[model samples]
Target: MFRPLVAAAAVAASFVVPPAAAAPTPATPDQSASAQQVRSAVTELAEGLSLEEKVGQLFVTYLHGQAADEVHPGNQRDFGVGTPAEVIAKYRPGGVVYFNNPSYDNIDTPQQIARLSNGLQRASRVPLAVATDQETGLVTRIGAPATQFPGNMALGAGRSTRDAERAAAITASELRAMGINQNFAPDADVNSNPANPVIGVRSYSSDPALAAEFTAAQVRGYQQRWLSRDSVSATAKHFPGHGDTDEDSHTTLPVVDRTVEQWRAVDAPPFEAAIRAGIDSVMTAHIRLPRIDPSGEPATLSKPAIDLLRNDLGYDGVVITDSLAMAGVRKMHPDAEIPVLALKAGVDQLLMPVDLGLAIDSVVAAVRSGELTEKRIDQSVLRVLRMKFLRGTLGHPLVDESRVDASVGAPQNLAAAQAITDRTITVVRNESLPLKTTLKTTSALVTGWGETTTRTLAGLLGGTALPTGGTPTEAQIAEAVRAAASADLVVVLTNALSKQPTQQALLTRLLAVGKPVVAVAVQNPYDVAHTAAPNWLATYSYGAGSMAALAKVITGELKPSGRLPVAVPGPTPYPIGHGVTW
Candidate 1:
């Protein structure tokens, strides 16, 4: 699909500025001194560790509170009480990833999760790098008062670097407060393909430059370390690029066939800028790039791709692989062989290997048999230790378990999220806002996918609610149109009209009515391209904060200031940056 862009990308690459000449960050005096000291500490720690400890430092395994009723393989260890201590004693992994399963309500509160992290630290000789995928919006692992900020697309729509920084800073504060030291976020992918199932709202924008700016802001924000707390390492993930592919890597390996120049034009800038901004980690993607590496290896186990990150981008920080459990990589190799392949490919840490004990043994065997040298293992171990020292995990590794309740979702954090949401509700089309003045009444009909969401929007507008299930039947659309006939105005809420045929039908039905119809996109902004509604709004999120912010925008309490982060596909009346003000 992207093959034709090679020539244009080649021309663009010549004009793109090298990262060496990029704008320098305004680092404080204390930060500069601490940076050198942290590096020295990491080197010293690596030299003192034994061979067994060095082997352990290369693996970052997972520990989820498995559901009591659910039965699965490797369920022997519950990760409760004595079991985790024994596992850690034998395997001695470098880090542990926390996962919240939807099927089970395990570690439901912040305090419980914090206590779990503290227990894992106690069982390890070196401090564990506790991590989570707290990307906000649908991907946020931790729930509740922990401000569910709008996703990356909303931040791109707002187009405020400061807002991007604020969102990351607040997220980092909460994670560190709960004893989690790493955040796998601020996705750098340039979402060029609208059909991308996995990287849709996760990416900041389709424009490489815009994504680069926000990615850099997020990296700076996450590494800032407020309130004198330990910093949470910010990761710029799915390296090289995951945006051009339509396939999701979770179920199958997506192939991106763009030339190296195409990648540099659309994907490399963000990673280069992130490296310059001092990103603490880079995560490899599972997708295969045929043009970049002819051997047909996924980026996780390809030395050329990893070398591009190390040499071309000049990123010296820790390089971590995306979870090995994903079918993209799992289908390619056995559990025991994955750790060795990742290390030989220049990855510093192996994340969520299928079998932790088997992975450790494979790396140990590789070193002894000359397949992998002991010195090569030491290099990666040094980088992992440096990350822990830089994040303060080695020094002040423990959190005050009592403070977890007060600090996890502080009221101020929610306020910041709301403020960002308020600034990011994009008005793509409008006949003038505060529909009360245009229609001469507050009475309106609000219909959407869920009853709760429809009711929330209706209540905010002081109107009646009509729930239109995602796939609305003809009878349901008829009922909604009848309801719209009596109202002063009609507002239809949609997530993605391209994906939802019923929602598109409902929009067409509402527009058939003589009354003015306004369409509000709660999730994907692409719906606006399908409707000719006089008023259109895009929030890029269905999160609570974004919904409340949308309500304020509809009632004229807050102005819609956000621009479109990406092109609204199909036939849109507006350009990429189009938005209404006042």
Candidate 2:
């Protein structure tokens, strides 16, 4: 059952004053209690916890289920528990991470998620830091009924810090309404490598300065108190930068070969800006930087690497590992040993460990054997507790589930998303633009990589929708060609054209149909470099808002104001900040 309002207030009041004459100021939405007060409260709380409970406070794990009380086979196998409530009762983890993936079905509807959050919190002795990767673009874990933005690169292309801040603010409000107090967002990695498989389009820009500015703005937006007493803790991720790697950390450890100086110049600026902006947390990257830490450990396990954030950047907040279950961190140590090493290396919270039971037991064993001191455990616990206090999680862990629906995808939030996406649509080439003018007496055929995106675009333009797969088959190309022949215009949507040769072939065939072809790169603007289509536009996302923005640009309802955040190097090379305006 949800904690009543009066009970919550009483619980909040218990932590208000220390057992001293001079009472410390209570934490507000924007500021935490005085350091002394928080430390005193944390110390008193720490003194009462058992070794296992203290170690438990250092972890934030993900369980498999939508509701906290629902039985899940995966959770049963992983935790010897069938429900999130049982897992929390048994493990007492410091926090919980939410995912919308098939394996971890933690998010469904807004009210369902709110109820789930409340259930999880009720099962916990301490307030659980409920978090999700709501980074707004490609990494958004929660989808529709929640306003979707065109992503970080779209915001980068729009080149407005105000838009970046507003986007984050909207996301924070929605996330808090659903009872999620933490968000891993505003990806600070500068997409310096066009070939970077993981961080492309997720990054703000290739320019360090621009990435820094936007990162700070997003941090401010996310941490700012949206309601009088509620705000989401914003985390700047992949610290030291994952922007230069070609490999995904989920599969293997990638190497960032920048020198200490080069890393400081290219990769460190955004993190610096994030720290300066008072970001609540910094997530370590799994990538190894040989120059900074020659010990051959990923930053998540590298003392020198983490020191850059601690000593150099002076970030004294929570430090979380990306995911111990990922191959990048797993390759170095055994499943049980990874958490111990991450803690020894200075990460406060172990996120998504491979085996929560084994990880906690290992830490407990390490403490017992004197390998890791209890003081070390308390330090991390205090940091986590301090953050929870500052973010108002301790006081108001349970949200009013009834109010969730009214805020999740509010109309004003949707409009903010559309307005941001509209500003991010970039027209790279304009040979047959303002399709409203050119196709006044003719019809258009929308054929593209994504079936839904193509159909949506077709509906918006009142054109025929010929949806094609990401890799269009020969028969699909033929069908698109036949469809193009009957239409006066062809709006070809391409996603990563360089990777999908079959889709590129479809674009070639549609262009040859002798109807004017307008190519819209829905996912990556770099798709423009691979094609010679006389007309090109880039929306950086295939989201609904992006589709609307694309249709409006084609119809001349909105002018393209977005610039290329990353360089496109091919026949017609486009530098950073290149965009065509009418």
Candidate 3:
């Protein structure tokens, strides 16, 4: 069972650097203009910074408060030594990552987030590139009042780069309106393994080519100034790929035991395509590939892996580390040491360092002790400054707080999200779908893990809303069976039934009822394979827009056109890209 959808719970110009050769061959007109501008800004900014300030430019830490564990429904005005604003003022960090999670109580609304970002920029001498993970569907950190679209898998199901582009464009437009310039999104990893826990629906597809197309489209959308004058740079994440592992890096280091040839054929293409499309940054995965680096260090701390990204794939733009606080990286080194090692490993930005002050100080100390050179520090700082310059953050640091309401969650954007989501409803097994019956007289029984689906079904089909408890018991299943006896059709909505034993048993009971049943998977598409229902649907997400699309398909208002983005391996073979139309 998963959370409900639509219901409950849950730059510049300036100086020039010395040429390597006198009168070197010139770069192309259009492409070299922006590259030259970045180089000029980086050289200028780097010249004006102290050693401590230069070191700070390489680290991006979490913006959390003293009372981080407590929930403050209102604005938290405590900008002290360790606080977010205080960290910016003291360390002069190049960037700061924002989180509105339950553990931290800083952000409650878009206006509050805008205020926080604005305040941090005001405190800093160099405008920090305020960043956040705005990966629309399951990973949306920005709460309600912002338009939440279906994620990459949903977009992949739609099988349209145009939809992927439009969704990302809309996302970037809203993020820029809120003053955030960088989005850690458009996951380029191929979901090659069905058992992969972390990146199931986060990835676009199992097929490398399909994922590559969507990733490139998303990168273009995020960078497109034509979509919105206010554009947010997209980061293609978990590089060298985080889609084939069974382990989660948050808890333990994941290992991808594939040879170079295998990785090239499967996981490397999407990242290559994203780089070609000019993505702003590529975040390193904490996962290890023994075939690539026999030293056994995660990609975030592996120089070989970094070289592979830089020289092999030819991705020159900022190489960011996946949060150093994770167990994958932290288990290998202490908080103070992560900064120095990450920089030495060729990471341009040390993201979410475990200890903010210690990380900055250690990098400075590392330079002094010959552990890292000043030139190495300058290399990363230059990239960071280049990103800020390219994003126009140096020119305009603060956001207009008043525009939070009018700009984000605009009606047109939400409509586009719903339309895109509607296109991702893959009907894997539809037996005379669209009900093929008159709705008003039909006695329909709707049941699911949460109240949202039941409520939605009742509103749509005049059905009995039978909401199941999380991991239902025998009694609940019996009650559902009794209800299904008199129903013309039974609609079962599931989140992840494969993992939920009680939900699986409930499905077994529903099948025994001998009624016309339709099973809809609201989260993982694999649930369709576990149930005996002849009609199976995959919304690919539980977002409001995703559910709205599902509702339209159920009522025959819209045709089900989405295909399976990832392969669902079971007794029934539902290959990636398999779909059924109305």
Candidate 4:
């Protein structure tokens, strides 16, 4: 159903590394980069690339599922998109865009990603860009037992740029070790609007200056980690002002009505700072900005935004397009016409077009027919080659065992997650009504919460999926309510509402339930005011630490001391930064 489009957008896009020929590494090599020799080996593998293959390096197609997931019958894998092996042997896209679905074979370990990078390159016999949304906190793609740090908003509020820089460095180190060469992170889109559909916690801050500072620090942090080889390149994304738009681009084109003065002041600084900081890649957003291009082609197909990057900002790196299949482009042109238009509009590479081969052919045919210049194609290939060279994946596949494995998400990683959980597990307010010491209720009402799910290994916690402010549908809530009615203390594990309708409605509904409602806020401090559920606990970011912190509070491992650091508006039902202690 339409849920697929919404579900896909539900994947919160998010972020990070170090050093030199003398070599650079992070404090911990939880995920270590490949050695220079391996990088050299990969570079050597690039020596025999053909003309078509060289051209193929300019497009990054989004395959259907994960690398480990086997492609099934009836699922088309054309357009430079498919399993890592098939996509390599066939479409040979220059870069690959990952959709975080391990069930389809894509996974949560650096080793798994490294194996995918190796397998894909081995089949294609050419180096490629391995990228994903690895931003920690809210928009993280890689999760589970791994260290999922606080989101940009939290980092924006943390121990200064130095702390953020270290976080970014750690992130890049993790990605590089996993064979992920490029990170589509450091969301420069400032969280200027609270109701903005997509880029909320994903943005570094509501303030432009802070967002710019954190974005730059994070990118620089990741860049500092992997010198040149076995490093990860940073991509600052959603050019212009995707942060303030209320429309969700995945399903609809959200237009930013800000005047030129508004944009020049509010939306332009973060990106300007990122470019100035020497970010390697800049991605176009799908938002329609009439102030810039009134023709309604969206930034991805408009020359103005791309020109801003080149002529105005003096950015000479690659210009990456957001996925072309988004309704943003479909609203203006034929699906096949997306890649062609983007090329003509000054974009370097078409990202994740619906049909890989068709998209490639469209670009190729445009070049051959002189509609798109061959020189343009070469320029993009050169950029792709440069990145491949930098990462040392150019020569051949290097599947080093030490650089990967499930242990990447083992103990410490989960412990880090738990630590973050404790720090962010804020108690906005406490009535001293429900005591944390004693088992207050006979039947505990546990609701499904968190960015993903709340499934415990032991199955001891039987909670209904209370997908608050996140992605729970009506059907999901109906089930949650039924489960809550049978419990004594209802724990509503609610996700933050960043413009997801169904989830928000479910949370609003959960408040009236006649039980001791413990609302678990996952993403933001704002959710405290959004929920009417009297008793609430905030796990600022959901990860191992958050989960552990919540468990500790429930089991008296630690007492609730965190109060709401931010204020909430009244008449909003649930007041801002609101929290309750047992």
Query: Please, what is the whole-model Cα lDDT of each candidate in the order they appear?
Result: 0.78, 0.85, 0.79, 0.63
Per-prediction count of colliding residue pairs?
0, 0, 0, 48
Which candidate gets the maximum TM-score versus the true structure?
Answer: 2
- The digit string of per-residue lDDT tens for model 4 on 22-122 reads 32211112233433332333233334455466567778866554453356431352423334466666777788766676423366456666666666656
Better of 3 and 4 by TM-score: 3
Q: Give per-residue CA lDDT, model 2, range 1-582, as digits (tens).
A: 323323433444454432331211122222444445555555566666788988998899999999989999999888998999999999999999999999898988898999999999999987889999999878889998988998999999999999999999889888988989999887999889888899888899999999999999998888873122446888998998999999999999999999988989999999888877767888999999898899999999999998888888777789999988899998888898899888888899999998999999999999999999999998888788767765778667889988998998999989878988899999888886776554456698999888899899998888899888788889889998988888888999998888888988998888888988999888877889876799988888898899998888888888889999888887678888899988
Question: Each candidate's TM vs. the true structure?
Answer: 0.89, 0.94, 0.91, 0.76
Q: Pick the candidate with the highest lDDT.
A: 2
Q: Count backbone overlaps in model 1.
A: 0
lDDT of candidate 2?
Answer: 0.85
Q: Give the TM-score of candidate 1.
A: 0.89
lDDT of 3 by residue, 101-214 (tens): 755545667777777778787777777877889898888878678888889898999999999999888888788877789899988999998888899889999999999999
lDDT by residue (1-582, candidate 1, tens digit) is 222122222322233223442332212112454344444556666766777789998888775453223333333443322355456666888987777884223356788777767777777777788888888875888888676888899999999999999889888888888888988987989989888888988889989999999999998788773213535888898998899998988999899988888988999999988887877788999989988988888899999999889888876678999999898877678878888988888899899877777788888989889999989988888788767765667766678988887877788888788888899999888884765663235578889676778888777777889998788999999999899889887878887677888888899888888787878888777778876778888888877777788878777878788999897778764567988888
Worst-scoring 10-residue span by lDDT in model 3? 1-10
